[model samples]
Target chain A: MRHLVITIGCEYGAKGNAIGRKIAEDLNIKFYNRDLVDEIIEEVGIPKEIMEKVEEGGTIAGKGAEGDVRGSFSKYADLTDRAIHVQKQIIRKLAEKESCVIIGRSADYILKDTKDIDLLRAFIYAPDEVRIHNIMESHNLSEKDAKILLLEKDKRYHKRHLALTGSNRGDRHNRDILMNSSYLGIEGTAEYLEELIRRKFGSEEE
Target chain B: MRHLVITIGCEYGAKGNAIGRKIAEDLNIKFYNRDLVDEIIEEVGIPKEIMEKVEEGGTIAGKGAEGDVRGSFSKYADLTDRAIHVQKQIIRKLAEKESCVIIGRSADYILKDTKDIDLLRAFIYAPDEVRIHNIMESHNLSEKDAKILLLEKDKRYHKRHLALTGSNRGDRHNRDILMNSSYLGIEGTAEYLEELIRRKFGSEEE
Candidate 1:
């Protein structure tokens, strides 16, 4: 079998991207995040508006803004459904090609049935205060704006996950590892997770 | 409120002692393990033969054994009630003194009724191969003897835990952290558990 497939799911600005990037770099494997969004749009010819809505946690109506487009727009405009399908495709393709680190999009459930995929699924999160501070520092947003944005992003992600998989995004039942970035910090959490993976699947240095 | 009373339960040679020791050391708290056995012997003055049998997984009869006996006595005896009571007394005394780490002896169910006790329970375990190797190295025993010793020890511990609590020993349902020491070596497991305890207690270190 090939190397393990590590999937990280997290709220935005929870340092999921940084952790994924670090794991990919350390293991010398490919990393996918927003880059998969482009591939998805290219393959399905999804419009920019729908892509933005889906990425930001909104649904795209197929037609007439009501219920006319469920089966018409090639893959439909239900953003959550479309996102799930696109992510599944990407994960399948990645599995066929090589093992790598994938961030978000319910990859844990997506690749649940695949073989030789030692899926190390992790849920990354920080407290509200830590998340708000992170948003303010990274996006140069006001305190009120950061809090509002964080709350909305959290809601959307939760909604999208529920709509896609009938479960809460941060539920421990769905994850192999539930880590608080606020406690371990980004580097420490990543190193700890790396050690676990290495121990499960032999050290890379070995 | 007092500091948390942490209990770690695991099969023999599962690194529970090492993890408990590290957590106690790092938090600058007292830890009770085999020392608990000593305390029980001193307080109850149970005979050495009975103590050996009880420690090795035999139980006293419900009818004949006296609550107190001293020195060497080879006669068969029942000290189950006394043993249970003494163990509970030690746990209560420890709780009264300070927050500390207690290894085994059904501390979870013992301290289950106490308020303001942040009980961080953990189950530490490893693969059979890893555990067997550990036993050999630690006890300087041959492979065959080590395997037999490990099997008997595991059975004894399991039965003792079940006898006391009416539940399986080291079950994750009763634990806050279900850790595999096989993945994280002794030091790494301790570090991870310390991080978990800090999070559970809402320590300011974060």
Candidate 2:
């Protein structure tokens, strides 16, 4: 059987990680989230703090140190780019090895050019109102704050992802399944995706 | 309270009609499918046969009369376009008065420009496998036939809709929700959309 890899890109507050984790559990395959990628990056000697900060919407501008920080800006940008490149390399290597579910880090685009493996790309998203409600409850945030945070984070992630992948997150052509998880619930969404993946490759499974 | 309308564009065999019917029933509003449009077209002096044939994919050419009937193609096309325009006018008038769920007929794009009405555009689609299964069971068709019919019908609808609306059905920006109802039974899908609509305009309801 060919190696089957599922790549899931999600909108912020869409419970994408929860859905991806559930799919991996149901399929009995490994799942890779950002934390897993962080571990891989740390193993290569990149500071965990720098990776975490980058993950949290890039390095903060040095406090009132504007003119003094132009050099650091370029340095931070290069480190972030390097981090993304290494993550993509890790994603490609993982897909070549076995069946797994990968969440984010543009795994879909990284594997877009692969020919030998079975790749299923999905993007999970939700309406803004539902997303805001989820974020507000999960983070103990007010509705206004939740809305602002979700938008800001999504913008940053989208720009970074576009820069790295040369593709948009929710482009339908690149996806086998583009769905709103807001209505499907986490388990329902995961189970449906499992069925789709199984149906796509089940004939070849031993 | 502001007027609200939900426009659903769906791939063939996606059970979009069932979902839309349920939503209208739950919300106590009218549901307009092709039949409703046909009635309006017939009232305008177009033959029911032409409208029905157009609805059934623009009239298949008679087996032996292909060349003999080539001249009628433009006539049929003109009638079909007229039917669609009248349907859009009806859709706009309906939105002007009350909240309702409309299925197909490019209602999403027809109502796309209304500023006073709260329009929620959704595209309901399923993976090819699940859709084929639905079509086979519902139409008592062979799998191969079902697949062909689905593909052909979806292509036709997509082309006609694009020409009428200047928008693609599943484009994310054109839709507030793009969901797969393949796993979420019709009821689950309807209930979720109901919640979304309620959250959007419920504050102004008396």
Candidate 3:
């Protein structure tokens, strides 16, 4: 009686990607995080440089360097838009076919219109100072550089999300919950969310 | 190793008050909601009509009544401002002495600077339609009236919060989590929150 699907939109150093994967493992569901970028790259033939920029959590606001995308502003925007649409199709199919946890890529917003599937959308964020320290440790960057990187990633995330979904991630109108990763850490958060999701969509006989 | 203190900020009709009280019960901690207002009224000698107005979640932007507090706008504003000061004192005292769950009145922000205690702040909100329907059913009002009431309460909550704390409740830099009550209902939400609170503040040996 459970068709549980969860989408996690997260800040850069919040470790939402790790939390989502842990939840999927605990629930024995399919986990789709980086595999998404791979699928879009394979299916849509998104340029490698563009995908690499995306991996760096950057917006396509600047110039692109080579042959495929032509480096024009409008064309770069167009390619990113096209990639978002393809990502949407891939997300919808995954939700419709099986239970999975999707990390970012606006999957929560993408699957919001469905009624038959049990979907739980959560955004994981920690304090800026905590996230900054995390990025410093993980990326071997200075405090100044980590702060700059965090802002850049956040801006790019919002820009891409707004273009595709007409809203940002924290637009909680359709989202189910928001969690701060600091209090529970990745494992504890996954444990709590797993229980919460089960309670939300579990069989009535319980 | 637990010095438990929780503060709940909520949108109208989200049942955050109920959730807070239930968490207190489950945790066997002190519950502070209306009592905070009553204490402010007693300690500050705040006028009855204004407290009633405050009870209705209305800002002190307008006039007051006769006798104890002059019916002038300035006097009315002065009284409520003084009451908020008393309320802050009461909140700090409670957090210092005992474990408790406080509802609204910006207790979360009031206690944000402390380090001697364990604290978890949560805001509860529901979908507009669900909350509006709840308002209509509970207050016996038309949908239009219910929507108006909801907006008024939210505005006053923010206005009072800003005037007191220089920030609003949904401000997440200091708050811990936000939960939507529609999917879990009050009891279910309370149950999860009880477990979450214990996990957040319990002994390290666990």
Candidate 4:
């Protein structure tokens, strides 16, 4: 009774979102990523303004810029916390229902304890230089600016992982597979992961 | 009874050799890389010339350039095969005797089945751009030339891995830790591996 469920955690610029998207399409399953934010909004009634802000380098934990749209940092923190809690519930419910690929939001840690489904937890990472180059090309930023934003985003991702799982993201023991996406490129990595999943869980349609 | 034995396999220009050197210095353990060639020569009675040629991409498997130095392709292949077989034995004996770090020559695959030591199998890699940048800077080669060499080296390495292990090196399941050395720089990767070794085998003296 091993249903296929994949959770992917990735460093910024690792093309994890692209890989997850491809895997979801290949598997013919639902893909959850930033769309989970909307689901959280629907499930928990978190305001869209705060969710958007939180999505854009705005941390719920009293640690972002000082452009308060709604209220104090603590208020947003509470809302963000509540939103994440609801997001976890929605992720679990989705996994229980059918096969799907979930990216980020500490979904690997969230689903680690589930027993009913076969879980493939993967962590994708790339070199800083490659990621910085990617950000510069994609975001129309200078080298210095891209480096700064990439590092900040990495810090925020790490903080979020710790906040969610009480453990660092680079801990290899926690992952079923750890890959360097820069070596394989986005599409190559997607193909690699697809083959890996098929090998581990068998090539059965969901 | 856990002796720290690390096998570091890396892509060209990933600075894996530098990291292995620093780890050897830091841990005060024997570091084996090309030195394995010497060991193989001594243990297997292979000629120094053939071993050196094989080490320098002159695979006796008829895959390399046509430069007949000593004998026919089949004879050199037989010697190279014997050298690798003897090298594997030497690697295991070294691990059984003392803590050490070995780089490349598929040490990860060789010592994987060892029963007495704590093995930390790591694969260090970097994006083509970053590795090409590194090669250009270090080897004083043009970017075009550096890229050519890097790809050729990667192809040779992949071929050797397939020859030795009968499996593709990029398979993530083969490694315990996969890191992008370009992200951490050479010294930083060294420090990272140092910390990882300490965590796995404790910080006590060997």
TM-score leader: 3
Q: Write the per-residue lDDT of candidate 2 for residues B11-108, one digit (tens) a residue.
A: 88888889999988877777877677567667877678755555444233332246546567656566667766676777788778788788887777
Indicate the worst ten consecutive residues by lDDT in candidate 2 chain B: B56-65
Better of 2 and 4 by TM-score: 2
TM-score of each: 0.54, 0.56, 0.82, 0.50
Q: Which candidate tops DockQ?
A: 3
Q: Which of 1 and 2 is the better model by DockQ?
A: 2
lDDT of 3 by residue, A164-199 (tens): 677755666657888889889889998889888778
Assign candidate 2 its CAPRI class.
incorrect
Instruction: Flag regions of model 1 displaced more than 4 Å.
Output: A37-41, A51-83, B1-99, B102-206
Off by over 4 Å in 2: A48-81, A203-206, B1-105, B108-169, B173-206
Instruction: Report the C-alpha lDDT of model 1 over B1-206, residue by residue, as the tens digit.
Output: 56777888877887889889998898888889966655666666766555445654434442224543432122443364565666677777776677789888777667766776666766677767778899999999999999999999888888777766777675444554456676568887888777666655767421
Better of 1 and 3 by TM-score: 3
DockQ of 1: 0.07
Q: In terms of docking quality, how is candidate 3 classified?
A: medium
Q: Which ten residues in a row have the lowest lDDT in candidate 1 chain A?
A: A55-64
Candidate 4 residue A200 Cα shift, in angstroms, is 33
lDDT by residue for model 1 over A1-45, one digit each (tens)? 566788888877778889888888888887888667456655776
lDDT, residue B57, model 3: 38
Q: What is the TM-score of chain B in candidate 4?
A: 0.82
lDDT of model 2, residue A32: 89
The TM-scores that each candidate's chain B achieves against the reference are 0.83, 0.80, 0.79, 0.82
Per-prediction fnat values? 0.05, 0.11, 0.70, 0.11
Residue B100's lDDT in candidate 4: 84
